[model samples]
Target: MSDSNTTDFTNPSTFILLGIPGLERAHVWISIPFCTMYTIAILGNFTILFTVKTDLSLHGPMYYFLCMLAITDLVVSTSILPKMLAIYWFNSREIDFSACLTQMYFIHCFSVMESGIFVAMALDRYVAICDPLRHSTILTNSVVAKIGLAVMLRSSLLALPFPFLASQWPYCRTNIIPQQYCIHMAMVKLACTDTRASSYYGLFVVFCVIGLDVFFIAVSYTQILRAIFSLSTKDARLKTFGTCSSHLCAILAFYIPCLFSALTHRFGHNVPLHFHVLIANVYLLMPPMLNPIIYGVRTKQIRDRLLRLFTHKGT
Candidate 1:
């Protein structure tokens, strides 16, 4: 048992993050790829944001949602990468109690927000391809704004419980977290009090947010596919399906690792802790780094705008 005098029963003063427990010797080497991914994520997402903002032709509801996605990806990565890099590079592993909770909140909150944005983007594509004439009228600026607000509110409110639940628990156990960052379950595990409620509620929130979002996206894609198939010409069908390819890539990049991480966390009892931590980091980093690349390469208008910008800069 931890000595009462040293341990803060209410909540510890700080938590020590063991950056990839099994890979301690490789921390420096690991920091190299993490830093590269983070730099790419920052530059790529910012490019997306800048290109979307400056180009009026690209200011459709689709791009607006893309901007929202870029911002969400930025937050999701920024929330943890710096601290993680610090842990790896500088041996700065200690994070304040309140700050840890805040980081945990931001990571989970923005992850849910990203999923919601995927649903919004899927709906945008569905309307665009399935009902082209009404797409503009359906996803007006005001409506898009409202949707963005709704996503924010939904993610924020649902994730609010995480930090609150974590903060209230008594941490008489060790303050050392096995992962590079403070995850909800990682923090909860340190609490001496009953944690079943936290665990179950977390699963509930996952279902309510991510599960619902995935279902909606799947439905949207189903209708989209049907619409594509209904097109009489083979060329028309391919063309329409091509429009969704980038978004589909983005969705896969974000969700595949995300779901795997979630499942591993909840059920993969035999999975290595380091592997779980790596997956969690990849889930956060990969989408941010890849989304802009996928969109820039796949979307013509944004690609042209980016080319012109770079050409102008070169001249």
Candidate 2:
């Protein structure tokens, strides 16, 4: 029903995210490995979730944080993996504008929430290790619940500006996004108008949120180390350190990649696309993939529960 000129002038309302352009010929080859990774990530995190939920022994603050982390991993992986698979397998890369926005919103929201949760977990560890007697009273169910709510609220509120800024930009005729997923920066770059305001605002938000979270986490861990060193008995120090080891590993894995990505985007924009894509994937996939394993290997109670469950199923 439209005229030829009108049709020619109007950009398509949807975008086909052809991932890593030249890699199209390798899609099938990459898909096999990618799909395998996705399955493992899902199953691994799901097992952690199930084990924690079913085992009453894990009802304390540590497992409570683990379960929340598993949920965040599930949400983050689900947000991007299915879409990536579809693009690689069926060549169905099309994503509507609204759907893209939704994906971007949730991805940022959950990521920020995860950062806050990590900080909370660090605090919980510090309290448990540095002040064991008061651990129970300090991180009670009501207190943790309140902290969880604050995490969700803060993440949602902080990430709200990104989508709002993105929505204001008019899309150009050339709308091919270069990555597998709907990243906010990529979307903003595709806009027809000048993006200085949005870019600066986003940079400010990223630094403020991630920077403060990391700072608090670092401070908490420093005090924990001091407390550990102060203990005269080697056994006491080892036990306390062991309890926090998994969380420390997970935190390092999650935050380093995120900080690197943010730094590259801010200061290393001149870097090659391949480097960018690699770091982005690390930011997107590494946390989800490593979270379950970190928790499983580090936490004895949850690990035992998972082993028993699997053993029973095998029989």
Candidate 3:
């Protein structure tokens, strides 16, 4: 259905996001905490980026992927959190149709990119562990750069259909999006016309991209575990698992809530609205907040280098 046929166009061009239920009425109270979180997330991710870029010792396949993950986190969080803050603090819930679409597009794009980055991280671990002899040769700087570019391209392409399909839908009188940000599923649900096609297409994209990415990550870790256990020395096994423990935690932190959110949206809508909103936000915001800290605390080289860099300026 064309926009001309579906939407009245004479109606409001912008929509109100109701946000979460109890919080909507208490926007003032919530804004302070939300803003603080946004600041910390941005600052933390930026520190990782800066630390990795300037410190020569930190420049390796692991840190390269860490930098990419930081960049992705920054972009993704910035896309959603600022607008959410504006809505809560200033009562600025009116988002233009085009702007809404743009927001939805980037949310999808960055999400896919993050998934790809996780897979890439897994691949790095796989090479470092399973193919130890050729780890450096296989994950050379040029190769890492190429993989990063390919991840970006793949994510962009995968998300292209969402906005294109969304643009064609005629958004009639129902313009109230319950969430703070323009979520793709919520937007499609708001459309007056049949949205089965778009919904199914989205599901397909999610399964194909997230599913394949998770599968590869699982396989990489499986092989990694095998290599770790095969080591004759118990200390060697501990050391190997130690190197991957942080990434494993990060992967769980990212994927668990994401899969829960997706599943709840698809099969568990009979579940409470607050349940969905809470899980969705957790999936979106928690990883960005946790990723840098995880890498900084768990990775010895990164931790030592970051400490040195921070202490050097003070001295």
Clashes per candidate (backbone, < 3 Å): 0, 0, 0
- Alpha carbon deviation, residue 285, candidate 3 (Å): 0.6
What is the C-alpha local distance difference test score of each model? 0.91, 0.84, 0.86
**Which segments of model 2 are wrong by more than 4 Å?**
1-12
lDDT of 2 by residue, 192-298 (tens): 78888888877876788888999999999999999998999999889889988999899999989998898897789688875786688779788888888888888
Which of 1 and 3 is the better model by TM-score? 1
Best by lDDT: 1
TM-score of candidate 1 versus the correct structure, residues matched by position: 0.97
lDDT of 1 at 129: 92
- For all predicted structures, in order, the TM-scores are 0.97, 0.93, 0.94
Residue pair clashes in candidate 2: none
Ranking by TM-score: 1, 3, 2
Between the candidate structures 1 and 2, which one is better when assessed by TM-score?
A: 1
What value of lDDT does candidate 3 attain over all alpha carbons?
0.86
Give candidate 1 misplaced runs (Cα > 4 Å). Answer: 1-8
